[model samples]
Target chain A: MANNIYIGVDLGGTSIKVGICDENGKLLHQMEGPTESEGGPEVVIKNIANYVREIVASSSYHWDQVAGIGAGITGFLDIKEGIVKLSGNLGWHDVPVKKMLEAHLGKTVKIDNDANVAALGEAWGGAGAGIPNLVCYTLGTGVGGGIIINSQIYVGSTGVAGELGHIAIVPDLEAIVCGCGQMGCLETVSSATGIIRMAKDAVERGDKTSLALVEHIQAKEVFDAAKQGDEVALRIVNRAAFYLGKSMATLAVVLNPQRFILGGGVSKAGEILFAPAREIFKRFTPEPAQEGVDIVPATLGNDAGVIGAAGLNLHR
Target chain B: MANNIYIGVDLGGTSIKVGICDENGKLLHQMEGPTESEGGPEVVIKNIANYVREIVASSSYHWDQVAGIGAGITGFLDIKEGIVKLSGNLGWHDVPVKKMLEAHLGKTVKIDNDANVAALGEAWGGAGAGIPNLVCYTLGTGVGGGIIINSQIYVGSTGVAGELGHIAIVPDLEAIVCGCGQMGCLETVSSATGIIRMAKDAVERGDKTSLALVEHIQAKEVFDAAKQGDEVALRIVNRAAFYLGKSMATLAVVLNPQRFILGGGVSKAGEILFAPAREIFKRFTPEPAQEGVDIVPATLGNDAGVIGAAGLNLHR
Candidate 1:
């Protein structure tokens, strides 16, 4: 039998990425094209099919070797049905994505939210490779998460499993309303937006800090200031890490994944963020759950989405 | 072909319960006998073997009809090795339960902790029947939890997944040390022990409460007092229910189980505990996660242990 290859599509508002992965989830070939989502779902779907074919045509593997196609889309999705129920970024509603893609490419198709797809990518080939159970946290504009169990993405009853940012870790006294309308969610403190908010709040409160000098504050500025031994900036960084570690402690007992993978821009703060999160995880987690469990960074970076989507047909 | 029957053994400190369950996890027959811990591991092993034979012999089912045996023990277990690493309740250390049981029964045998077994029982034939994913909470002396994914008990790495009681939920200022040595754990406020403690604290603090008139405060007294409109007792009950609800909210996002099953003695408080817990769960959970999800009571009660034990081989 010929070796099988998988196709993964990272459908974004501005660009669509397509990658061909070998059985081991190693990217063999890749191509990128504009999404032009404004052209409507039909045009976007055709672009995805064309990109997938182009990737395979450029690769060493034959088209017959392509086992299946999978996509990681941003928005509320009906994963089982492969439908985009609502996508603010794509301006899509009730788009029958799987059926359209499968019709164009004549192959089985699968779809998952971007966070889950990225986590699966890491689990299949990145930081969580060979680890059957793991959790991934993406700390970008908002916190995102994916739960991987038995090497497959675990999308809970409504495909909302691993919504880690909404874990509600902050105490009421310190809590602020989250974008999800919940109070004291993990994202309210641990996300890049949350860190930036804290920095701005500190500056507005007239705390002695270098952040006051920055014209427009960002999470990077906060981390940079903290790295320079700025006390106020350090407090903000600790607060963000504190909630993250606490959320992980809660997840440790609930899911008991073998590893936790941290990704996204906020995680780039390096030891300034990870050190306290790891320490807090250890302090709050019961000793038994913490044994042999580790916290690590996602190794795939931007490629996790494409690689994980390719794994959907195989791992799922 | 003959129908298969499963043998389940619930090993406790003072008693050993044995039952026969059909493929559906329905308990056909059950019997209980002394654990005879003073006689040690060897005697208990023989006793369990005898009970297995006695039940099948007394019933219409033949010995050959029995397919496999499973036991649920209370302890720290090396599940993969089928060893009880430490069991404070059973006074056991490093007992190879699966090996000994397989030796006596001459059949395939499996073992898991009591909490996981009960949750499996509920998932298999009780309230969560036909639900492939769910979380179960046993609010007894200490809150115990089990995660069921794809109809199987998810023990996680090192067999410590689903230890919900130790989830640090209370704010640090108001939190106290838990038996697990963690502060502000969910069990500190939500377990039966937690409820009793709150009542004792209220009385000792010179609060004018009816609980002060009681000779020995139990969880039941607190519930009864609350039913009678005792303000302090109602507050304690509400506090217990509050944490349980909050923990469920956390679980909803993490596991996204189809249902949340509440079992154990404390759950018997019915509407008082359930109403508040459900309301809190709704308040804390994001709309999408809570959609189509429910919090319900466990139906199998004590039988859950034996039935879930019997299901280990089938489910696992």
Candidate 2:
């Protein structure tokens, strides 16, 4: 590895995690702070700066060895221009994030959408290591994806690449509404909310299961209940797996990725999630693609974000 | 611009089209032949050799100046090995096509899946020219795709990259059975055969429309009838477009493509096929991608296969 060190910042809706990393993609030090998103972009920027400063101060390694800094924030972005074009929850439109951070820190900064950065993190040092082409999808409050091809991120002609959550896994039939306000999106059916929606729908229709008797429930409750042999919860998780597997099969035909690493909060359901998902994938994917494709659970957990973000800085 | 010439061959069950071109992708000559696919792999090899000899005899270009030859065939493949691993339609399996043809022609030969070659042709000389990131989908008897990134084909770890047809567009419960032995594949609902299948299903259910009374049904026939005010046919075609559009939206996410070029036989339906597809695309795709992505019809038409194959030679 080179002698260079780098900085990593993970910008989430409620908090920010900042860290220092070596060129080999090792995290050296870390710091965190509340995003105070309601206070708006300027406040979040200040918080990000504070977090970065704390990491620099705390690291045993000196700052002079750092090459630059990178941030992973949720939004539509202009990677080439170093701007956050539109982030819904953040209410940010065309913010010159790179220049602002560079101005404050006196160091160069590279900012990418959080999902994109997470994908870069995975590709560089996490679950996707050594893979030339892959897609990392996180099923959380919403769905997000990162596309990596030939060891580099595929940022598209524009920067809005790998938005898998918005793809119409279901189309025109009045399915769940995606955050983008579209109907029948893969997001509506594959995320945690989607899983709950499915179980709730089954109950409303009088499908007999243990979940039908539960007080309000979430996707995790469903997965936990499924592990305990709840028919309704098991059914709901299975439904999500079916779609997730189908989506992977479709993804296979488009990108022909050698590996697919599933992560995020909902992925914790484990084989109750992956087993059926893989079964459906084998059933639905074209024969040739099914031959040797690897569908693995993401090795990185919560650390994926901070670690992946750090990895991004070192690699970039 | 180089003086070196190349030959491109497109192999299908019933017929084959071959073209002669220069290194810059300029076509110099062409020929067509019956595939005689029933004659088995050995006989087909002989036919390919004869076709190459005929092309050489008719060309004024010097044989010494020929750089290489390429072939694109309809089958699952081992691309790097230049083997046709399987073909349900043509009954081919594990045939060393490249070595046989290279030896017969006394020059190097390369082979690729037909869809990949089509994408390559567009990447080198057609609509996707000057663009390295693109997804080329063929709406033929089945939906097929090839991904191009950074001015070259991305054939995944197993040479099965770009299998767009097999992506499960419909959730299993709501999906139709695809010919590839699965439920709800994009190809089952979106290709030329897929459109006809839907039309037949719709008509069988007793919905009155222009196509209900037709003696023969084809994908184009349904599209033409729908144009003249047939409710059932219109519904069928729109439904197919809906699935196709949604699938493309998913592909946009999966591949982060700069362009989505629709080709093959059914694309001839034009706006009727594309307009609704565009609507679904815009509605479901995330912003930036929704605004920036291009869904254009393929430009090479029938000659795409040959040209694309030639491109494979020049590129791979």
Candidate 3:
């Protein structure tokens, strides 16, 4: 049999995770190694190539069975050319990932933003599998988004479409500056940073709440407090859910995805975040747009990037 | 010889415009007639079919040369089945336009929201022709939007995608209720209604401005007054541009379109509106997303709807 396997690389700052997947999008074998960024782009590229080779070499599938390689990278990139324009985490700029990988391994190479790859993974193997149109949100330190249209990542003209977190949903009086330098972006109030900021502000204001007693507050603590019906925590949670729901309403009209997959640590807050957000989504969106749409959690967890990266050959 | 002609119908409350286009998207022939909606949905459907047949008969092309018929309509619809779910303009509900038209004319039929059709028209034959990814904004009494991805209309999961005007861009403090029943939508500040409201508010507040001297204020008067250096009018115009620009910035990150085509009467204010909006778009959008994007006026004007509708069969 022709090596029907594909290699997937998830390039993070600290580590580079590589995996082999069959044609059906199932992850069969995986391995990881340090990125060694201090050794520069050349060393990192060599490490990635070595890791891919080792993973395939160690697997039952032969080299000929390896169909292609795909990479999921953080930050701005020229997706078609496989150039990492900028990655804050890896401290890379204009690194030609595809050309290098192809030269080393003699195979077709594809790369996309990490967020987009994760969404593709979910759409391929997780909650949104088989759905033609879906959007995924990673609600971690920041809110990141990916959009799939007709089963392909809808990278806009500049190859940077699906920046869903930056959509401005807050009205001006209550709006705050987002890290992207815009005012009232969904990320400002709905991301993990936003949730923590709200909790800290509540504590700083000396609100009579159980959250005040926590030695070091975090998003989990806030969610736990809200689950326990702590008034200040509930208010903060509601505000976050309100903006998230409002943004979903806006997105419901724009992309009209069949389902919305929520991921990342903050999303682990579960129903406390989802209930209010879903209610608000129904309230703000028109009935036609809201019909058949769903909001659900992601299933792939840390493996989404690698699997999605592997899927780039078939999906993107 | 095979018929390459496509028929387009632009259905409105007061009038129905029809035209024929070749495969190249050139409008070969055109005509207009009253909708007579008071005669009800059956009469309206009959009139549309009659007009399409008559136009083809009168044109150089024969009926067999007519490849397909497309209609651009207002309000909610079941696009997949060519059913007009509800049209406030034509007083229609559950009108089976595609089935009726197809049954009458014995040809394939397609339909879309007027805004979406207008966008497809621009993308097919007007301002955005040759560009695969674009967004169109119609700045009339109320704002409307359409999105084109890979030369096809992105009609979301429920055929209501591209509701750009409803994107909540304004901060809560300044938001007014939109016609769609949402609070602080972009339509509340950026539409012609929004412009006139701001001008009227200025005059009612006894502010010093050239608009105060006009017997009756309108969007044009407000723009002219702004062009004439009326401080109050300038404030009103700037606010409208500010929100329009802000919304574009939000969309830029989400869709990353190559071009933004602005149409409708309000957009005729030209630089007075576009200059500020473009400035704000640049300020609000990140550098990567901002690259190579242009904001320009829509070219087709009154013919956009018919041309866009005609394009649906080929593009959609």
Candidate 4:
């Protein structure tokens, strides 16, 4: 019999990505549409509904060949109920995303955290592809982590596992506060946003460096300047990499993943970021953990979320 | 038919604990023997053989009734080969614990890290009994942890899952160096030794407290003084709880275990330690993670290591 196709929905804040994936996770065809997120949950959900319908109709494939729909959404998901318990990005709270979409499209639907979906994507089709057990950290605005064990995403006891960004890396409660409103989370020093903040602080204090030349600097600007031999930029990048490395090393000792795949925009700097992170990772991790671990770049790149969302069909 | 008995051997640096467990993880009979560990691995290995044989023979439960032997030894085990890759405590490196034990005991042997064994114990019969997922934090001389998902211990790609002690809760490198030789580990703040160090620092700085009356100022002394409302002791205890709670919160965000089981001698302070830790954990953890997630006392106490060792039979 022909293998069943699965619909993977990447429901983001600004855009909704949908893909037709086979049981083996091969993307047969894909489609994208604006989330219309500012229109609130009702309009955004309608856009998602239209998005899936269009994917099915526009693709050179048959609906009968589809097994089920697996949606990787950004928000708090009640996986068991397939509900969006609360979604900050989509501006939806307690929206029954899976049931509404499943009812509209007349099919089964499964929903999960986007970061978890990205992890599933990496685990099933990217750097973590061949590995059944691993964790992926996306070093974007904040550090996002995903865990896969026995070829399945671990959602903890109540459906939230792999939120590494919120972990308190620094115990100094008074010095810095995290996005989660906690003090001294790992993201304060390791994330792209955090890196920018660190660099901005250094520059504003009248430190002489190439970064001072920029009118308004972002994380990538620091990376760009670092590439051009900016001492401050270099220091900024190294500091970010240092903490990230420390974070990964600490994660390695705890989770002991075979590979640490770095994804998101900042990861594109490639060897520049990875090199220093590796050196520092070795310095922090113990002998046994460092012995068998490999620090690798993410293979899926930007499409990881979409691909990972699609991979969910196979498990369903 | 009656379930066959399983032999569980716990090889610690100071002592060797063995148990005869049924399929349900109930210990049919148990025994304790001196490891005379400093007597070398050969002697330790022999003691394990003699101990198991002695238990099986004395219980009137014939050797045939005993299934296979699962040993949780103190070291980094090469799971596939059943070799003790390393042990900082036992001064062991590259020792074939399984092969030697199998030859002497005339049975197959399964080997894993001791903490992993402790996790298994809790999962199968102790605090985590009947629970599908949990993170066990053993607060001994140093802090150690094990992650159990779906009743099976997660042994990361490199077999190092649940080495939570090594995760960095302390941000700076020079603050405290772990005996694992890493800097600012969670163990540095939460471990028994770390607690004593904190108390000593307070005393050295002339903090007024009931704990100053003690000669050596151990962790328990501080806990007792803190219970009596000693300012210095309360400060030290609360500080330790903050780090511990932060660590637990970080782990809870990532692993999302059903329960955070606090074990080992330090945990004996009961609510004096757990109460503040829970408060900090709740304060630090994000939504859904904090909901229904529990920070409970370890139920199995010292027997956790032996019982968890017993869990290997069912896990494999």
Second chain TM-score for model 4: 0.93
Model 1 clash pairs are: none
Which residue runs does candidate 4 get wrong by more than 4 Å?
Answer: A1-4, A13-15, A22-24, A34-65, A88-93, A100-108, A171-174, A195-216, A229-235, B12-15, B34-67, B86-95, B99-108, B197-218, B225-235
Q: What TM-score, over all chains together, does every model reach?
A: 0.99, 0.84, 0.91, 0.86
In terms of docking quality, model 2 is medium
Clash-forming residue pairs, model 4:
A121-A308, B121-B308
The Cα local distance difference test for each model comes to 0.93, 0.80, 0.89, 0.81
Candidate 1 per-residue lDDT, tens place, A1-316, comes to 8999999999999999999998888988888999999899999999999998888887778999999999999999999999999999999999999999999999999999999999999999899999999999999999999999889999977789999999989988889999999999999999999999999998999999999999999999999999999999999999999989999999998888899999999999999999999999988988888989999998999999999999999988
Q: Write the per-residue lDDT of candidate 4 for residues A1-316, one digit (tens) a residue.
A: 6668888888888888888876666667788889888888778768877887788888766777777888888776788898887788777878888778877788788887777888888888788877877778888888888887777877888877888888766546334887788776778877888888988898889988877888888888888888989888888788778777877887787788787788877788888799999998988887878876888888877677877877775653
| Cα lDDT tens digits for candidate 2, A119-223 | 777776677888878888888878888887776767776666778787776646557677787677778888998988888888899987777778987888889
Candidate whose TM-score is highest: 1
Ten-residue region with minimum lDDT total, candidate 4 chain A: A166-175
DockQ of each: 0.87, 0.57, 0.59, 0.66
- What candidate 3 gets wrong by more than 4 Å, as runs, is A1-4, A22-24, A57-65, A200-216, A228-231, B1-3, B34-46, B62-65, B198-216
Over B182-215, each residue of candidate 4 has an lDDT whose tens digit, in order, gives 7777788888898999998887888887667789
lDDT of 3 by residue, A1-316 (tens): 4648888899999999999988777889999999999898999999999999998888888998888899999988989999998899889989999999899999999999989999998888888888999989999999899999988888899788999888776766788898887777889889889988989888898988898898888889999999998989999899999988887887888888899999988998999999999998887776767889999999999999999999999887
Report the lDDT tens digits of candidate 2 across residue range B167-190.
Answer: 777755668777778778888878
Q: Give the C-alpha miss distance for residue A12 in model 2, angstroms.
A: 4.4
Model 4 accuracy (lDDT, Cα): 0.81
What TM-score does chain A of model 1 get? 0.99
| Candidate closer to the true structure by lDDT (higher is better), 1 or 3 | 1
